[model samples]
Target chain A: MDEMTIIFSAFLNGMGIVFTVPVFSAMMIGIVAGMIVGLIPGLGGLVAHILLIPFALQLGDPLAAIAMLLGVYAVTSQTDSIPAVMLGVPGTAAALATSLDGYPMAKRGEAGRALSASYFASIFGTLVATVIFILFLPLLRALVTKFSSPEFFMMVVLGLVMAASLSGRSQARGLLMAGLGLILSTVGQAPGTGDPRFIGPFLYLWEGVPIIPVLLGLFGVPEIIDLAARNRSIATSAPVKKVSGLWLGMVDCVKDWWLILRCSVIGVVTGFIPGLGGTVAEWMCYANAVASDKDKDSFGKGNVRGIIAPETGTAAHLPGAVIPTVAFGVPGNPPMAVLLGVFVILGVRPGQEMLTYKLDETFMMVNVITVGNIIAAALCLVFQKYLVKLCYVRASLMVPFILAAMVIGAGFSRLSLGDIAFFAGAGIAGYVFKHLDWPRVPLVMGLILGGIAEPYFFASIDRYGISWLYARPIVLVLEVMIIFMLFSTPIKAFAARLWKSGVRSEGSKHGDNT
Target chain B: MAITPENNLQPVDRNQSIAFGRRVDWIVSMIILIIGIAFIIMLQSLPGRATIFPWFITISIVFITATYVYGKYRNKAVWDELYDPDTKDGDEMADTGPAFVLAHRRGVLISLGSFLLVVAMTMVLGPEYAVPLFVFGSLLARKENWILAVLSGIGLWVIIHFVFGDMMRINVPVGFLFGGFN
Candidate 1:
């Protein structure tokens, strides 16, 4: 079939497949459940994904299974902003940047506005990504294949650089946290030689520290401690403004339409880079917002534009992430890796043939994503006014509930005594980091990317040697881009000044002539 | 650096703040440097390719941390300029009151004790009994109402039993108190 014909037919078939009772119902359930999971601090889509694995395996219909799973995945980044905005605790690492400005806004009684902005920005980002996905489908092979080990290395490097930029106060602390993360990633068995480094006596260490428990420890436990310390509700003020201020938040996003677009592009590009994933996407977008804005001081302090940038980045990356997963059979992120396993269980192979012959299935997944996000966004908008009240509950009352969630969340990793032990240890470390004013985000980025990057670094060294690795055109291009990114701020500042001077000179000349 | 509310640390004369900041920085950096060195030593003992990546990371860590400590020691201005918040001594620095017990030493001991009590109880009594006790103890320590605290404790245990133990089929650890009694 011709490309256009195939696209048309597949999209039509996909609509039929997803709109059915079983599929749509499953999708709705997944969306609602995912939102709940995502709203809870430190519990995110991965937990939801794991919980629904039984359903994914038991369901007979492929479309329904995919719809359910993809629905959960799509909504997580959207709803995860709740805890972020309300408590200054991110539900997931992807939502970390959201909390930068979001929590501040909530403190100022603008929780409604933040939620509304997140909802609108998420929808806009998802829609833009969907369009980008469809337009880029035919070109995905070339796009994905261009990134090999060297390029991947460069991308990881770029992520680390971005993490350093996120160091709100001190580059030293940010770099320190990031370095610690890299060290932590080396805990498991060696990538090449199968030699264990830091497992000690525990067999669990063979797989390295699980990201969930660590994240929960790092972000979740600290918030609980803060709550305990403050001895009050999340919102410090009484008489939080009437909650239906979503329209104002939505208007805020509309005002920063350019920021949304730029951040969405960042999301898409970061998503295309295989190992960087959503964690990096939002941070990079946040960094860009901080870099570009004249009033940089307002960021990390209740700026609506801060919320818009990260939310858009978080939402836009989903479809972009799937492109490489579909076209190259390489999972773009961890959740995508899980979805790839689901695909295999459903008797669908993902490679060039799957991209071509199973175009219908691919489109079905895409449609699920698009529809799922819209539904999630709408539902969030509908319920967020009520949900915003969570900010008002006394921390004393909330602690038991949150503590239960935290303990259970730790157990979700392995259901062993060790998981709790590790969580406590990591929790203490997280507390220390937060206490020391260390930027915690880079530590996480380092942990995630270190595992991916180390293997590529070794492989590139062993196979092609250092010179050949650097000689690759793509590697060279990415390195140049990294350098450019490093200096772009000063370059832009200089250009701005030049333009102003030129304009002033032109005006002066015009005055003389007159 | 611009001081925001997040960095609610009181501003003093720049020199005093710088000295305070440097003292904390030196301690943290030294600790990190020690950790890095320890890791490097540990990795050095590992065999073959396992040593390679870990060694690289530990060395980088050592370099960064050492540099941080040395810089702070040599120039207090750098430390002051980088100072954002002092989370390390957050409890001591926090506003003190009856409600803010967690910021006090007594409250901290209670909180830490409750956590340890939970761990010990879980090992002896399993999650069903231990979790609620821990929750109740913690809430009560935080000065919550007794009835509400006890009720919340029970409610939390029930949820854990039903949700995780039953629905998710997680193997809730049977404790020594059970003595292998199923």
Candidate 2:
């Protein structure tokens, strides 16, 4: 067949698979299930993906199974904003940025507007990202091949630096926490030699720290503790008299189309890079929004743009994250990593063949992202009135329930008592960090990226020796980016001072002329 | 004394809070420096490749902590900038009133103590018993109505039993006294 004919045929076949009764129905079920799971704080798409793996295997049909899993994966970002906006609690790490402005808006009785804006922004982001995915599918092979161990290591370093610099008020504190996280990540056996480094006596440390329990402790527990301490409902203002701003929220998204587009691009780019997922994407977009706007103070103070930026970025990130997994078997994020495993179990080889003969399967994923997000957003919009009421529940009543749910979620990570102990420790530390102004996100980014980084660093040195640092073109480019990222704040501050002095001198000269 | 939305309580003397914050920072930084130094010492025994990353990170931690401490001491303005109360995004600092401060401390202690107590209770009594007890006790301690607290506890137990126990089929720990769920 000619290339055009093959493309047309693959597209039709993909649509056929999606429209099939079993696949479509399975996807719908997964979408609903994912929305429910996303509403629960700390239980993210990663856990849901793990739980559904066995069921996906039992289903016995590749297309149906893929549809189901992808359905779950794509929609979690849509509904995770619920708890983030209604309460100060993020349903997932990706929703953290949403809570910055979202909860404040809720406090001001605009919960309906915030929730609606989030859902619409997410839907638009997914649609835009799906289009980008399709348009760039042909170039994925070329793009992924350009990266090697040296480049990958640089990317990881860049991610860590960016996260550390952007988070919290003090860049130094963020870097310190990130460094601590990196050291903690080295607790397990070394990647190259398999020799235990810092396990000490506890066998649990040999596997290093599990991310989920630590995440629950770091983010979830501190919020719960604070809520309990405050002794009030999440929103301190009078009860919302009306939940009628859903349409207005959608209107806000439309009004901010340019911002959404820029954020979506940021999302897609970050999501395309391995190890830099929704968390990083959302933060970068939030930072970008703050940087570009004249009214920077409005952010974290109930700015609608803040909610729109992160929501759009994370939503676009879903499809961008899937591209590498489909093309080169390199998963973009943790959930996509799980999806890659599902692909292997279903006897799908991800490579050139996925682009050629198995193209239909890839397109099926695109369909899932498109259709799944629409369904999820529609459902959330319809039921958001009831969802917003969760903000009004007394903290005394909500705290224990949330704590129990968090414990149960952490327990599910390993089904071990050690994890619970670790969770408590992390919670205490998290509370302390929260009390102080240290950023917790960089620490998390460090822990996650450290394990991936070490192996790549070793591989680069082993294969290319020390010259890999300066020899590789991509590595050099990335090194420059990292340097710029590290020094950008100081550089910007100095430039601003210089500009003010120049302006002052110019005004003095004009006065002399006068 | 007037209340503010951000502070949520009558304003306290700013200088006093900054002093307290600086003391807290000193303690925290010193602890981190000590831990980093200890880790660096420990990494000395590991093999070359194994120690490389940890050594770099621990040294960085120590360096950063030292720089932070030194910077704060040399310039009080840096401390002021870093410890600005108004810059806080989420939860604000507790009021500095003596009674409110005591209540805040109590709240922190209670929160931490409850978490540890529940974990300890679970180890002995299993999640089935521990979860309901924690919920009921915390709600009642918060002075919630007795009937509502009891119902809330029961409602949580039912969810745990049905959803987690039955639907998910998680092998929930049965506590040391019970030996096992079996």
Candidate 3:
């Protein structure tokens, strides 16, 4: 009864933050802005978080500031599918899998249906993930305590191994890009030794490369280039059709409630795995949909199941990501890392103490995530009917506006000529990678993991030595998972061949018996 | 069994572009290898513990690049078999031909040219002025309506200035050339 009271009060405290006029207004602004950002290819929540933090800090109330930023972060996953459905350009990495079916649906003039399904699944997934997060609070310590330095290092390795799965068919390219990203992470001044490894003459290198510009260059620029090159509107064949089937789309989401549940489970579980992040969650869920569904071949070809699976996974991972962050002070992704930085700026330390003494804040975070998800989904649904018309806007006209936004957005990170130059370079690199068929997401995953991985790896080695590091229960579990993931592709292939041979043998035996 | 270029990336004439396009992958591999070697060399000055992770990374990069290059030579058939199919389907705008240059050469030049123009302007006139110039110039370059382009340019500048500069108090750089503005 005492525990239940604590839970109830915490929930009320969170709701109080949302109801406060200033915080609620800020959240509304964030939700709307985040939706706009998510509609633009290559501008994701990270960009929004980076752009808004300086402003959020000035907002006076700490809870409000967090609410606003969390509002933005929560909405981004929900709306990133807008562009993926409309133009086949995912606004974020998590939306990449959504484009597989969403874009095809748009091409077929079913944009309204696809968008509606995404919004419904997104809200459903967020609600479910939040409930799971709240219910799992009691088990948090037991689950998180098993993770130490060595375990973190293994998790980083698992992230890299899992990158191969994202390659689709080009596993080698994915691994290579992961290596490249890891290498890029080591470019700045070494944390322990204070040795400037690659700064050269640029003082900016001391802090390492700013991720925003790099991301913009890698993801945003390529899309812009593609848009301009096409020299036409995004939707060629599809007219600005009425959102007639939107109701049916929502019905379809409910009909496929099992899929949403399963993918949400996939997302929440994968979210707990350090370094796997949203991209992996969405991709794994997407792969699951393709593998398990009866109409497997229809994926990447306007299947509503494809759209729902990724959108659900994207939303489900948010609470999962928040769990590790508030409980362990370890971020699940780059934006979450930025959020951790905000925690420090606000003079708050996140960890076990936060879970105990600061239960109200934790609950506020949970409620904010839940409320933010609802508001974002509602806003998208209201505007999607009109926003779907953006597909008819000429690429030439839209490209300039997006480019301006990208430039301004990238500039928010740092005001340096080097930053712009770095973006240009990254843009060139992005184009090359896109052309060469290299898996770009692995590179990004590597970049995200590298900074966190290094210190943990060195600390584990120094404290436990390599042999003992491998012996820890959690580390051993992670190792086994990594090894299995590494070989799972080949194992599945072999099994399929075995099944085929078995069928042939059975047929021969039946013929002989006859 | 030589690596057949992905159909989407292939030029209109495969035989004509293969000579140039096929070399792109090898060249990229060599460049990555050189970068790895350079990093390894740079790490030589660092303390041993600080250098360990970097060293591991650089060596891995070299090993991977070498293996990729060797496979290109020795197991061309595997490369041929493993190459991903063109999944773009009918998306005409998908990255095709030389992704760097792109099919519409003029469009690439205009977009990149306008980007450089914006950077150059920002250095002289600051983001406040440069943003409008970039928006208008790029829109004009795309041959859009003058009134619409101007309105958009001015509107975006207002949003960025008021929101970022005035409200958020983020320092938008005052150009060194504009001494009075600073």
> What is the number of backbone collisions in each predicted candidate, taken in the order shown?
2, 0, 0
User: What is the per-residue lDDT of model 1 for residues B1-182, given as tens digits with 9 covering 90 to 100?
Assistant: 11123235444433344454456667767777887887877776788667777777788788877776776667664456554233322222222211122123353454455555665666577667777887888778768799988898889787778966788666665566776223
What DockQ was computed for model 2? 0.35
DockQ of each: 0.27, 0.35, 0.36
lDDT order of candidates, top first:
2, 3, 1
Residue A360 in model 3: lDDT: 79
Model 1: which docking level applies?
acceptable
RMSD of 2: 7.0
- Chain B of candidate 3 versus the native chain B: what TM-score? 0.73
- In terms of lDDT, the poorest run of 10 residues in model 1 chain B is B93-102
Candidate 3: which stretches are off by over 4 Å? A1-23, A40-118, A164-168, A237-260, A267-314, A317-369, A465-467, A486-514, B1-21, B80-106, B123-125, B155-163, B174-182
lDDT of 1 at B91: 29
Local accuracy of candidate 3 as per-residue lDDT tens digits, A419-458: 6667778877887776666656667656655766787778
Best by DockQ: 3
In model 2, residue pairs whose N, Cα or C atoms come closer than 3 Å (at least 3 residues apart or on different chains), thus clashing, are none
lDDT of 1 by residue, A1-514 (tens): 6666677787788778788898898888789878765554333576566456444444667778778888999899877787677667665667778988988888887888988898888888877887777777767645545666666666666656555544445666777877887888888888888888777887878878676567666766665665554455433344334455678998988889889889888888877764567878898888998999999999989888888888899888887778766664455665665565456446665555556677777887878888898898888777864554555566566666665566665665555666667767777766656554666667766776677668778877787887854688877876886677556654775799799999999999999999
Query: What iRMS does model 3 reach?
Result: 6.2
Compared with the true structure, what per-residue lDDT tens digits does model 2 show for residues A80-122? 7877877666756788899999988988888889888998999
lDDT of 2 by residue, B9-91 (tens): 33464455556667777887888788899888888788887877777688788988998888778778756755555444432
